[model samples]
Target: MPIYSSDSDNETMPRTKLFGRQRPIRSVLGGGQVADVLLWENKGVSAALSIGMTILWFLFEVAEYSFVTLFCHISITAMLVVFIWCTSAEIFNWTPPEMPTSILDKSTFHEFASTFHERFNQALSSFVDIACGKQPALFFAAIFCLYILSVIGNYFTFLNILYLCFVCLQTLPFLYNKYEDKVERYAGELTREVKKMFRRMNSNVLSKIPRGPVKEKKAR
Candidate 1:
């Protein structure tokens, strides 16, 4: 994109994000491990997570196993393996699995907790407005949101939809970030063409429709 801006100074500008975004993608994604996995910065961890999700999907969707049952079986197997390893390590002098000193970093935990708190506070504010009848717009907006969710729920199970969204998050942003200029150019062209077509349609078809009320039956 930088090279494109240099080559076609009039056509494209430098330092522009997709959709004219203001913030960097990393900052928008909380600048964390999640962003790394999505952006393919840590390919090994990303691949492992992708493979794990695939296996889980196969187990739940193809094997028709309930989540609770599958989770319990997995937990039992992991515990058994770890217990055996720990027990046999003393006799065989095999190395034991190393434990992390901190499972979740303090910053990450605080950020996660604060996000929940903010969301709850926002929800409460909306609810209060609704209860006091202060903002009818909020009430209608809540209904619209519920209607949209219900429509989506008709087509997809919760897990299925969640998995599809996650897959998109993994692939779409990476591709867009990669081919930003081409995507933006094409998208802009398509938008202009669509608007042109709509205008043509309006002039040719919509204009011909009768607008005024019909004359009163020729004074019958």
Candidate 2:
């Protein structure tokens, strides 16, 4: 099996998948930069995110620090450092660090807002449909998931959940990218078993269920 890569930019090269994946792992991950970080191609960024999450988890989960308290402490420390740096720079006739407005301009904010708006609208539409019972199976699935999450929430703090999710996100993608051939074989077998069970259920159980008459829409 040819290992997938962001470097496989040639149009003639056929895209590979483990089972049902359409795009390259890099494309699924967004782009080369994101794939690089996740795949350990960029060790610096991966390490930074890992270390940052660990520290945050330690502070919030282990230390039991409130977000407000942490924010205040961070702000005070940052402001104090800036103040001291400015004062020292003035006394020693040295240049001080300055942030440019161009770092986060209107275009970037607009792009972010647009992306958020699209995703939020999509989620809102799905939520509305699920709540309205447009699809009974989907509605029940959502309910089941929410109930499970509620039960889990009772035991795990938000920070714990977030940290766990972060760890999984960091690890799973890399593992899948590396050992995708083996994973694909396992996934293929699992999928076949699941489909087989579903077929049996449909034939043995679901096929016996009574169906209501279809309501035909009247022409105005």
Candidate 3:
């Protein structure tokens, strides 16, 4: 009898499931040779662009009333013209737009619901476990900080604060990750110096304090 190898069988198998039922989506829209170009491929370029855009947005509102009006007028008119021409038989013949399809079909609603339900339950359980775990000082501090922000947010636009946070999250994480090794080393050195300082203070205090039981000197 010949022994069948699982690895060989797996390697020979085709990725037919995606194509079997529903048509597989192309990696790039409109089947272009080059796939999507990422705006943030380079962290430095992304940071520069973000800063420039933010400054420009602040100095002169990018979506000024006149600019927004012009944009809306042009886009809406073009879309309307194309849509009417496509629908009417009196003009150039064109088919009605196809209804967009989703990865999860209506038929798979039950499966989608079950999957989300399971995921939500797992997330809730994990969150509770973390919240109840040892060393929750940072976690509680974060909650307190958020509460303070929420209370004081009545004075300023909450949306503005949220947007600033969004920008920081995008920009800061990349920069930190790039220089993480140096940051860790510096932090480690600082921690050691702090520990040494405390140790020295502790030793000096102990030396100054009387350690042994003293015999009373006779009426000196």
Candidate 4:
């Protein structure tokens, strides 16, 4: 004999099925139109702010102060570089491959630091692509050479030497592909661990049941 009957199964069937046929074209089209409108609105706002900043920069430059002018120029240049790097990164989705187990088994801090370094390099690469028209090796070489020149010109002042070290570090991306791969692997592992921890905690709580007395047992 079956534990459940056909009528019982039908009664237990969900009011709303979990899986069903896809929606009609009219519904999808309406959703797409809403998304398009949102996108356009966001872009329009960004453009307006960008134009406003440019106008403000121009006004600042018109004021006859050398310090203000220099500050404005540097700030604007930095903003442009950041904006370009971010936009290019988003467009390319330049995420590297996961790190191998051999690499990630090392120190956690070292792995996380490496991941940060890799992201920084990717950002720099995007900037180089825009500046040098996508010749990565040449771009790196030019940057390295400039750092060398700056150090030599400054006669190895502490600040200049520090800057040169940073330049060399940034140029590492051009030399080895494995760095980005390792970073990605470490990041993935960390994410997996976090999710697993949360899941374990959730399961532990869910497995606990409230204690209650049965009617016959309580009566006894």
TM-score of 4: 0.19
| lDDT (tens digit, per residue) of candidate 3 on 1-220 | 3233354454454433221333322221112211111124454645665776576455334344355666678799988986776678445565655555775366446644665576688768756765776548656875788799988788756445755775774555444445655655556556556656666666677557877888888995
How do the residues 49-154 of candidate 4 rate in per-residue lDDT, one tens digit apiece? Answer: 4465455444544443455766788799988987777777778996543434573234544644665676688778777675665776667777887788877877
Identify the candidate with maximal TM-score. 1
Could you tell me every candidate's TM-score relative to the true structure? Answer: 0.65, 0.62, 0.37, 0.19
What is the lDDT ranking, best to worst?
2, 1, 3, 4
Of candidate 1, the 10-residue stretch with the lowest lDDT total is: 1-10
lDDT against true structure, model 4: 0.51
Model 1 root mean square deviation, Cα atoms: 9.3
Clashing pairs in 3: none
User: Per-prediction RMSD in angstroms?
Assistant: 9.3, 9.4, 18.3, 26.6
Candidate 2's C-alpha lDDT?
0.78
TM-score for model 2? 0.62
Clashing pairs in 4: 99-185
